[model samples]
Target: MKGIDQAMNTLPCQGCKGLCCGPVPITGKEFKKIQKKVKTFPRKIRERLERQPRFFGTCIFYDIEQDQCGIHDVRPEICRAFGYHKELVCFRKPELATKEKISFKESPVGYLSIDFTWKDF
Candidate 1:
């Protein structure tokens, strides 16, 4: 994961907005963690993030203004695997993708944006 983190650091993610961030598959544990994280945010910050506009398929936790994941620290396994695994290659830097594919030990309970929403938290 550290090696993948290093590789992903070389990506030009700042200006790309959340084009690569879409509805993500997350486990029940991840959901609980995210719920905790979101709950920690101040009311103003939480509302601001929730009000931000995103592309049709974008993740709900995507911070459009900051152009990054709102809950990066507790992001799901698939989010961490993204742009590193062959199955989750980054379009901007495809070479950074590893030959291996990602396999989750625990199947996702639901998708972040599609199945769960701000109301769930």
Candidate 2:
């Protein structure tokens, strides 16, 4: 996974404005981690994040101001796998996608923006 993480760091994600960060599925463990991370955010930061307007279906944790994921370090497995797996290729860099598709070891408890919102944190 470290290799995959290193590979993902090479992606041209800085200017992408989280174009690929739409609704994502998360396992219970991932959700717990996210919740804990979100809780640690200052009230102002958390509220600002909760109030931001996102494109329909965009991820709730995507910080539009930063143009990046808010909980990136504790992001779900699917988020980490994005652009590196064959089935989750990045439109901007399809060549970076690998031949193997992502296989989830744990089933998703729910979707990020759909099933759980900022309040859940």
Candidate 3:
């Protein structure tokens, strides 16, 4: 596992607003595993996982009010591996991390790249 992944697993997500939960990607196996676990998967979640290794916006399992994952235990590999290398970014409101610029040396997944631009979203 990469240093970022390891850090994510260990570090506490304090005051997070589920920014990372937006547009998460998962493998087919992971998707199937998730489907089997949830009794009733939300339409958005089903659509996202229907296609293998696709980017889906705003994880259906995320509790907006709580600002946390509803299914933390069964979250996808990509979700599990996501974390901040340094400081956290409030992606929902880019202005929060204005002074901080989050950049990736490479894509988290070999084929997928995270389009994290402050101005964009």
RMSD of each: 3.1, 3.4, 11.0
Model 1, 60-117: lDDT tens digits are 9889898888899998888888887898988988887875977789998988778998
Model 3 lDDT per residue over 38-64, tens place:
546576654444332323455555655
Per-candidate local distance difference test: 0.85, 0.86, 0.49
Find the candidate with the highest TM-score and give its number. 1
* Candidate number that wins on TM-score, 2 or 3: 2
Per-model TM-score on C-alpha atoms: 0.90, 0.89, 0.45
Best by lDDT: 2
lDDT by residue (tens digit), candidate 2, 33-103: 99889889999999888899887777899998988899989989988888878898888889888659678
Which regions of candidate 3 fall more than 4 Å away from where they truly are? Answer: 1-12, 40-56, 84-121
In model 2, what are the clashing residue pairs, if there are any?
none
State the TM-score for model 1.
0.90
Q: Better model by TM-score, 1 or 3?
A: 1
After TM-score superposition, the amount by which residue 24's alpha carbon in candidate 3 deviates from its true location, in angstroms, is 0.7
Total backbone collisions, model 1: 0
